[model samples]
Target chain A: MLTKRIIPCLDIKDGRTVKGVNFADLRDAGDPIELGARYASQGADELVYLDITATQQDRRTFSALVREIARHLDIPFTVGGGISSINDVAPLLEAGADKVSINSAAVRNPQLIDELAREFGSQMVVLAIDARKSGNQWQVFTNGGTQPTEKKLFSWAKEGQERGAGEILFTSMDHDGMKQGFAIDPIQKLSRLLNIPVIASGGAGRQEDFLSVFKLGEADAALAAGIFHFGQLSLPTLKQYLSKNGVIVR
Target chain B: MKTVIIKYQGGNVQSVAFALERLGASATVTDDADTIRTADRVIFPGVGEAGSTMKYLRERKLDQLIPSLEQPVLGICLGMQLMCRFSEENNTRCMGIFDVDVVKFPAKPLKVPHMGWNSLHNTKDWIGDSLDGKFAYFVHSFFAPLNPCTVAEVTYGRPFSAALRTNNFFAVQFHPEKSGDSGMRILKAFLDQSA
Candidate 1:
């Protein structure tokens, strides 16, 4: 039986790790490499480094930071944000990233997903969808959750799977950083809809939130930022809690 | 000393080389027999269909050359499957280095490709100490059944061989390259083995 994964997401800007309250009011965390090593040692199953800044200068800095983080830990790390083309993925994977995640670029050009899945196996490409509830439907959001998409969540997820996305990292814009809990309804719906593994992100206030996602939402993994960054919950402690709750974790 | 990664139209060699470089070991990626034969340790890392990979290996005469190696050799993922007797994928014949057959998971609601972290139990030899009940990442649709060569086991819808060892040749169905520190420790242990 595969165990549930615990991931720590480090949002990067200007080569430094930062966290925000609902993707606003960015606050510096620490050097990315140092923080990545710390998380790896703390038993984070994987690390996600997303470059929040869209500028060319920050992109270069983010790439440099990825190399530094890759140097410090021997774990699977994913690099996302500002990934526009097939060419964009090569540098990050070359710089020691195990996987490259795409968001806005993938939505704009669904063909890019197939192209990437052909070039690099589907396992190397991760599709990250930021979703927000719109009326009765959960809709896709882009541009750091500031822009909304017309595509329905289920349709986009199905397309992503068909286009060969190895994994789906789903983040609920409404629950992000609030830590009240995960947006279980959307996650359960998407997980049932997609064949690929779904990693639920956002709204993990306590360890039970992770348990809730795995048991109720059927998520393959859970990714948290603020709880991990602010030292409110540690990976080991969370794993222990999940294990006690009858959820297999490692 | 530089490590040589046998490039046979597989996957994860770049990441494996990069991981080694971070661990203070320089690595060379090539399919050249001479380069592989002369390297300190040869890593046969692959990810793809079994028959096709073996076809490529035989085309380059590496199929015969790999088994003759006296140095430590590590096989990852599909590389491990090709090192076995036969694979269920496409009903293909394999290298037969290990006396086991790769079979598809029994049909059910369970996913075909068992993807994610799973614990390795019932171990032996070099892998026994590090991976007993320890989680390692796995992603495969087919698996090699437990046999005399089975070193570690992981349960995913069914219990199967996660690691297998036969003399100087060690193969793991899971990607130790992407399996985090415990995985790195396995790599370091393999590198430290005495040939």
Candidate 2:
């Protein structure tokens, strides 16, 4: 049986992890390689490194970091943030990132999804959508969730799947950084709508939040940044909590 | 022992190389036929559509060159699918090293990609000894069905060959390079195979 995935996201800035990672053995929180290795050892199903700024010069540093991270990790890792074209995706994949995720760029140009899926199989492409609840509907946001788009959440997810996105990562702008819990309504809706796996992002405060997202949200995977970076919760404990709660976690 | 990773367009080669590096073996990634044929162990790793990948291999004549080799050749993911007789993916024919067909996973209740880790069972003395009841990471839509050559098996919606071995040729539908310690041990066992 396929198990639920537990992912720890690392926000990278200037080639360093943004948050101070508090893994027990590692002293350097800025060292993404160390944090990633720690997460893997602690039974993280996968890892995601988001380049916060993704400047022209930072791409080089991010690429280098990806190479070092890949060399150290045996599990799959994904690279996202500012990946707009095949040119941006190639270096990261060449650097050993198992998958490359697209966000604002994919919304700006939906054909980019097709091009990426064609060049490197769909499994290598991840479509991340940032959204917020508006009235009775959810609105898709872009440009680091600062710009609101006319596209709705469910339709865009369907379109992404039609264009061959391997997985859909839904990040709730309202729920992001809230420490309350995930946007259960949106996650459950998307999980029912998309045929591919849906990864619920944002709003994980407690261990029960993980269980809630898995059991209630029906998410194939859950990604958290602060909870993991600040050592609010470790992956092993989280997996154990989920396992004991009737959720099949790896 | 020297290891050569057969590199072609649309394949994830770095993780495989890193996996070997973790086991104290540095691998050389190459597409040259001569380098591949002469290597102690050859690894054919890929992550792409079967038809296009086969075209790339045929353009470089790797199709004919791959099957004629005498060394222990390991095919992974699309590599294993391409090693079979045919693939329903884009309606392409493949190398007939393993007489099996790669078919798409059924839609609806069971997901297509069959992504994530799955346990392997049913043992073959040489390759399956250490891997019995061990989990390995897999990410693929099409799978090779159970056959005479199947050594390790796993089930998603139905039973499928997780690992297949026949003399000098060996292949796995899972990504040993990305499957943590168990995967590394499998790769080590493959490398430990006497040539």
Candidate 3:
């Protein structure tokens, strides 16, 4: 009876939630705590907080923001972006993040995934991959998709899972922001390939797109930013749509 | 009521503390036997390997202290697994509170880490029928099978004990703190028992 998850992502910059989050109720809409609480109230399965702020001072601010969000919301949230070392993960988790997603760091040193999974549990480590398709094969990209590595998407995913990653957050760089739909072929491939739950990220435009990702893509979860951020889509409405379509959603 | 979260080396203590805080209760994370014994309620929270965790507990004499305590006790995830008589995880022996064996999920078709939101049905009335069919978050590879101590059952590959109750001891394999409103209700209900 495991239900598919629907997650709304919040990108944080300068201690303020930037990017696609466009909430009108809170006078200070930048406050991630309010946004997270609203999403939980509307029945979001989980929330993802991506800290894009880079700097020693800003990382501290992001950690503090994570504490605020964890304190305010009852649902589980994963913290990602700019997480590099063991030190970076400890504070966010201590501040009450259920899981920490490592992207570029994991790509840089695959050992970091093992180390974090050892320090915390495998269930606490999420390996986030930003992949771009190249000539019949999808390549792993790092540094926010600016740098492409020689590592193939499937191999790196298998490696991450073998290294004790509890879950895989696979985001297709080519389909990202395009709103065309999720990278179904790659997602379905990964879903069939890996035992861990695959969270399909990037390019989720409408409610039906989530259905496609869940039914066709076979993704355990579907994450979106713009559509949910701009109030174009709501978690309740999307979940209801999926439920009506014979998909079990919670 | 005095509440104390039994602290071992490995566990997600902060989130559990925050969950209680939201329910208007404050708790201290401590390993001191006296603190645990004195508290009106004790929550043993964990997320780690079985053999090593049991070793840590025995080294600190918590293995002896935990079972001896006379108060309402609730175990979460690994905590609940450790309270069982035995665990297939590292072949570690556990406290005999639940009289069950924690075994790993079967390979193939069913994932090892049965991680996600799953609802509990066929629940005993002790935890109430309110949580019946309500989704509770779960993230664990090993599970305690359906037994006499089981208060509620959940189906992944098959029916497993999602929540168990015996005397004053209440335990759940799910993380209520991260399970939204339905999870909060479960926590609140446990608190009501102590009250």
Candidate 4:
């Protein structure tokens, strides 16, 4: 049986990790490379570096930071944000990133997914969906969850899978940074509907939340930010707890 | 001494070469057989369809030359699969250096590509202290089953050969070059063996 993965997401801006309170009030945490190594040593199954800054200056810094992290870390890392072309993914992957996650570019041109999947196998391409609840349904958001789209969560996810996304990283805006728990109902439905692995992100406050996503939500992986960056919950301790609760974690 | 990484229209050789440079070894990327045969060690790393890759190798006469080498040869991922007798991927015939067949994991709830780090158990003595019971990085849908040639084993849906060795020919289903410290140790060990 495949073990569930625990990931720590680091939002990179100007080559430094910037931690925010509910995606606002950003503060510099540390160097992206150092933070990545710390998380990997702490037993993070994977690391996600989202380039939060959209400027040209920030992009170069982010690329440099990605090269630094890729040189040091051994685990799989996913780099995202501001990636608009197939050419954009090449340098990041060549720099040592195992996978590249596309958000705004992918939603705009779904054909990019097929082109990327064809050039660099589906396993190397990840589709990140930033979703927020709209009345009874979840709506996909673009541009780091600022702009909204009419595409429903389930339909967009299905489209992404059909377009050859190897995995889906679903982040719920409502539960993000709240520390309440994961939005399990919608995630579980998506997981059941999609054959590819689904990584549940947002609202992971405690060890039980991780277990809940794995057991109840049936997510292939769980990704948290605030808890890990602030040193509130460590990965090894969490993995030990999950193992005790009959969750197979490696 | 510089290492020659054989690049024959395959996968992940540039990354593997970059990894070699990080380990203080100068690496040259080329498909020229002379360049590969003259290097201190040759790394054949690839990621793609097995049948197409073997076809490419045969077209270049690399299929006939790889097994006849006297120097240390390391194959990673699909490169390792191509070293076996046959593969279930595209019903491809492979190099007969190791008498094993690569088969896909049976249909299950588990993902087709067994991606991520898995422990390699039941290691052979030749593996030395460099690689024994240590986890290595693997990403592949098809695997080579265990036999007398198996040097290490890892379990997914079932136990499979993670590493196989037969004289100068060494192949690992996992990517040692990308597997961090444990993987680096394996590369160092291979270097030591060749030296």
Candidate 5:
């Protein structure tokens, strides 16, 4: 059986790992290479590095960090953040990232998704959508959730799958950093609506949240940053918790 | 022992090389027929479209050179698909080294690119049955159904060939290079065949 994936997201800024609550109030997590190696040792199914670095100069550092992280990790990992074009993706993959995630830039130029999927098979491309529920509908947000777009969550995700995204990583902005639980309703709806794998992000406070997301939300994988980063939950223990609760994890 | 990784557009060569390095063996990433043919073991790693990758292989005549060689050759992911008779992906014909057809996973409400870690069963040969029931990372949409050559099996939607072997050629649908320690042991086993 294909076990549900447990991912620890490392938010990288200026070459250091940090986690924010609701995408603000950043805190030092540790060195990415060390943290990544730690998670890999503890049984993280996959790792994702969101390069929240703002300037282009720091971009080189992020690639270097990715290379170092790749050297240390045997498990697969995805790299993203500010990746808008095929050019930006080539370097990260060259540096040994297994996959690349595209967010705001993809929304800005939706054609980028098609180009990436065509050039490098859809399996190598992941489309991340950050959205918030407004008036009973999830609205797509961009620029680190500070700006809103015309795309609705479900429709845009369906379009992404049609456009050749290998997987859909849906992060709920409203539920992000809440530590309450995952946004199960929309996640379940998205899982049913798409043929591709859905990775649920945001709102993981306890180990039970991981189980609920996989069991209730039907998420193929659940990703969290703060809970894992702050030691609020360790991946091995969480996997044990899920396994005992009838959720298969790896 | 010398190892050569076939240099092609699709193969995720760097990680494979890194894994070999982890095992204390170094590999050369190359497209030259001589370099690949002369090596003790050749690795055909791939992760690109079938039609285009086949075209690249044919244009460079790797399609012919691959099957003619006698040394142990390992194919990963798309590399494994291309070693088959044909693929549903882009309707492209493959190298025919393995007597199997690569078909896309059925649209049965299950995910297409069945991503994440999955366990392997009924393992033998270079894959090592000791590693049976061990988890390996997988990310693919197309798979080869069970056949006489299958040495290992993994079920996702249905039982499929996770690993196949015949004489000097071996292939695996999963990315063993990125599948943690369990995968490392598989690579080590493949390398051990160099004896």
Candidate 6:
């Protein structure tokens, strides 16, 4: 049986991890590769690095960072952010990033998904949709959640599935950074609506949150940043908690 | 050891090369038949569609050369699928190194692609039960149903071949390179002990 994944997402800026992590053993917390390898060693099923830096030089640095991470960490990892073009993807993948997620650029050019799925297999293309609840409907947001798009959550996700995205990493803007719980409703529906795995992100305050997301929300994977970064919740502990509660975790 | 990874139109080829590098064994990624045949061990690694990959292999004459080689050859993911007799993926006809045929997973109850980590059970020859009960990363929609060549088993909807071994040919559906320490051990054992 396929086990649910616990992923620690790191925000990268100019080749360094942007978030302030509080792991005592980590010599350099800002280093993505070190942090990533640390997580992998600690039993993290996978890791995601969101390259927030938009500079051309940063892209080069990010690519190098990805290669270093790949060389060191044996677990699967996905690299995203500022990845807008088909040209931008190959370098990261060649650098040994397992998968690349696209947000704004994919929404701006929907064909990008089709092209990426065509060029690379659908397995490597992750469609990350940032959305917030608006008047009883989940509206898609792009440009780091500052700009709203004309796409709805369910429809756009179905569209992404049709366009050959292997997985859907849906981050709930409404519940983001609130540390309450994951947006279980939409995620449960997303898992049912599409054949691909649905990764529930945001609103992960506690290990119990992961259990709910994997059980109630039916998420194939759960992704979080702040809680894991600040050492509020460790991956091994979280996995133990989830496993104790009957949620299959890797 | 002159280890060579067969290079064709495939992704994850670089990853296998990197994994070998980490194991302190540098492998050459090449399409040259002479290099592949001359190598002590050949790693046939790939991630791609079966029909297209097979087409590329045939075009490059790798289709003919791969099976004919006597050296210990290992196939990973799509490379393993392509080693079979046939594939449901785009109705692809594959190199018949393994007698089994690949079929898509049942699309109900559980998700396709059987993504993420799962334990390997019911082991046999070559690797034997040494890796039994250990977790390995798997990602695939199609699977080669249990056959005589199956050395390891993984159950999703039903039991399927996690690793298969026949003569000098060994193949795995899981990405041992991406399965962390347990995975590295498999690769190390393959390099050190496989004859």
Candidate with the greatest lDDT versus the true structure: 5
Clashing pairs for model 1 are: A1-B155
Top-DockQ structure, candidate number: 5
Model 5: share of native contacts present? Answer: 0.76
DockQ for all candidate structures vs. native? 0.49, 0.79, 0.80, 0.40, 0.81, 0.72
Stretch of 10 with least lDDT, candidate 1 chain A: A54-63
lDDT tens readout by residue for model 6, B51-134: 898888888899999999898999998999999999999999999989999999887877776889998899777666888888
The 10-residue segment of model 5 chain A with minimum total lDDT is: A53-62
Q: DockQ score of candidate 2? A: 0.79
Candidate 1 docking class: acceptable
Residues B26-96 of candidate 4: C-alpha lDDT, one tens digit per residue: 78888888887787788888876787789888998999889888888888888889999999988999998
Q: What does the lDDT come to for candidate 4?
A: 0.83
Off by over 4 Å in 1: A54-61, B8-10, B21-26, B48-60, B85-94, B101-108
Shares of reference contacts reproduced by the candidates, in order, are 0.46, 0.69, 0.76, 0.17, 0.76, 0.59
What docking class should model 2 receive?
Answer: medium
For candidate 2 chain B, which ten residues in a row score worst on lDDT?
B123-132
In order of appearance, the predictions have TM-scores of 0.91, 0.96, 0.96, 0.91, 0.98, 0.96
Where does model 3 sit among the CAPRI classes?
high
Count clashes in each candidate, considering only residues at least 3 apart in sequence or on different chains: 1, 0, 0, 0, 0, 1
Query: What's model 4's lDDT at B159?
Result: 89
lDDT of 1 by residue, B79-162 (tens): 899889999988999888889899987635675457778888997798856568888888777899888998898888778899
Clashes of 1: 1
In terms of TM-score, the best-performing candidate is: 5
For A26-62, candidate 1 gives per-residue lDDT tens digits of: 9988878888888888778888999988576777677
Which prediction has more favorable lDDT, 1 or 2? 2
